[model samples]
Target: MILRIAMIGFGNVGQEFASMLLARREWLLKDRGLDAEVLAIYTKSRGALLSKRALDLGKCLELVRGGRNLSEYGPESTSLSPVELISKCNADVLIELSPLNIESGQPAIDHIVAGIENGMDVVTANKGPVAFAYKRLRNLARSKGIHFRFEGTVMDGTPIFNLVEKTLQGCEVLGLEGILNSTSNYVLTEMTSGKTVEQAVRAAQKGGFAEADPSLDLEGWDAAAKITALANVLMDADTTPKSVDRQGIGGIEAKDIERASSLNKKYKLIARAEAAGEGIRLSVRPEMIGPDSTFWSVDGTSSALTIRTDLMGDLTILETNPRVTQTAYAVFSDILSVLESIRAGTAH
Candidate 1:
């Protein structure tokens, strides 16, 4: 099968996908019996344009790394910005990995709504818009009969959606919990370095684990958003970001970390969503778990989610990574899985 992919965000995750699509071109064609093309990538300003049809994968990577090109098309000056690209691009699948704006979900929400309306399938790693408009956007996609796959939105790309959707199909997850944010975890891990929370956050941003505005992860808003997505999709509940009570690690004073050390109990951003009767309760907060506790060991930007099922009781405790390398691979895994299912006409 052949496919055309429209990548909406050219950030670290977006660029990672581009690189992956290039690296695996030969393998995907020879092994998976799949032929594909990255139509284009819409980024902040004049996006990137590469036609792998003629260029070798290695040459493509060289151009991307140098931020220059050797094609008839000049680099950076010939492509549309992410916004204009979303509204104007053409493709069978739209990969939306744009940055998340919690307040508006802006471009992402608009992009997704527009994509579905135009009859294009969407796959994303952006949690802000999904966590904000789960019901509205989900209904829209379902009505349009488009596949909205978002496997990398939560974990370090640990296959959470289908882990719950398909693997535990007949079961019920009463309690969902995990280290949903890696930025905060990294900050906490650096507590012994004597760096202030602000200093640690800056380091995380420099390392590409946190965003320019790290409040989303530090304030627990990022984790809250993930919990909200889980509740809405896995639990079949209609909930919004505001509905999920949130608390961040921003308020943790230097003394608190010191105190935690004295008590031998550490603090970590724990996100939880529980089935409370007909309604669900979700929250993101920094809690103190003991030295040997399960959550206490989940450090840095790595996240772990444990699902308490009815039949199997407590099963696997899944973890998600924050690196784009892992996340982008997860994106491709999901893309191929969904595409294969679609081709077989057996996807649900």
Candidate 2:
């Protein structure tokens, strides 16, 4: 089977996924009997590339890595927007790796809609769409009969959504609790060691774990989005990040960290979603936990989630100090799953 891919948002994660796709090309063909080709790559500022034939992902990665614009490729470059390119490019899968828009899920939702409407399977690492409009997009995909998968939106490559969908069959997810934001966790962990909040944030940025504008992570918007996404999909809690009662790590001081440590506790930004009446309540707050807590040992870029279910009681998943490659693997794994569904004639 040959899968043609069109990607919107070719940023750090996109570039890294492209590299992984290149490296695993042979493995995909030989093991999975799948031949995948990247046909279109769209970026907000960098430039866009679209082709009827497979675009040279190697050259694209090289150019972007060398700090050159994708337009340097010359002929294959196009001026079309992502949605326009989606209509033109004959792709089997659409990959969305756009940056998170905490305010509203914009162009990312638009991009995914275009893909599903164009009769393409959609995969995304962006949490905005799921957090804001999961039900709408999911209904659209179901009506259009296409696979919509988003495993990388939270917990890096860790299988949260897939675990429920594939393994925990018939289990009702009652609630969710997690340390979802790596940047916040890293910052708090540093602060426990006597570093100031500002110093910890700067260190996180330098380590490439936090965005240049770490406000999203520091202000709790990132965790809010992640928790909202989890609730929307797993528990059918139709909501957005705005609905989350949130507090960030910004309120933590050097003294606060010291207090927690003196009490034999560690501060972590926890995201929780639980049943409330007929709906769900979502919250992100910094809470100090002692060694007995599952999240106590989950420090420094590590993320952990606990799922409360009817049959399973409680289940937890963890990913430690994930980097870009894990996120790339999320995309890769989703693509292969799509291919399997396609082969089985069950892509819907």
Give TM-scores for every candidate, taking all chains together and pairing residue i with residue i: 0.88, 0.98
Candidate 2 Cα misplacement greater than 4 A, ranges: none
RMSD of 2: 1.0
Index of the highest-lDDT prediction: 2
- Between which residue pairs do clashes occur in model 1? 155-320, 156-320, 156-321, 182-301
What is the per-residue lDDT of model 2 for residues 1-348, given as tens digits with 9 covering 90 to 100? Answer: 789999998898899899898999999999998889999999888889988888889999888888888999869899998899999998989999998899998879999999999999999999999999999999999998899999999999799999999999999999999999999999888887888878988989899888889999999999999999999999999999999999998888988888888999888999999999988999999998999998889989999999999999999898998998888899999998898888887854
Worst 10 residues of 1 by lDDT: 46-55
State the lDDT of candidate 1 residue by residue for 114-153, as single tens digits: 7788777788888876787777887888888778888888
Candidate 2 TM-score versus the reference: 0.98
Measured on C-alpha atoms, candidate 1 has an lDDT of 0.75
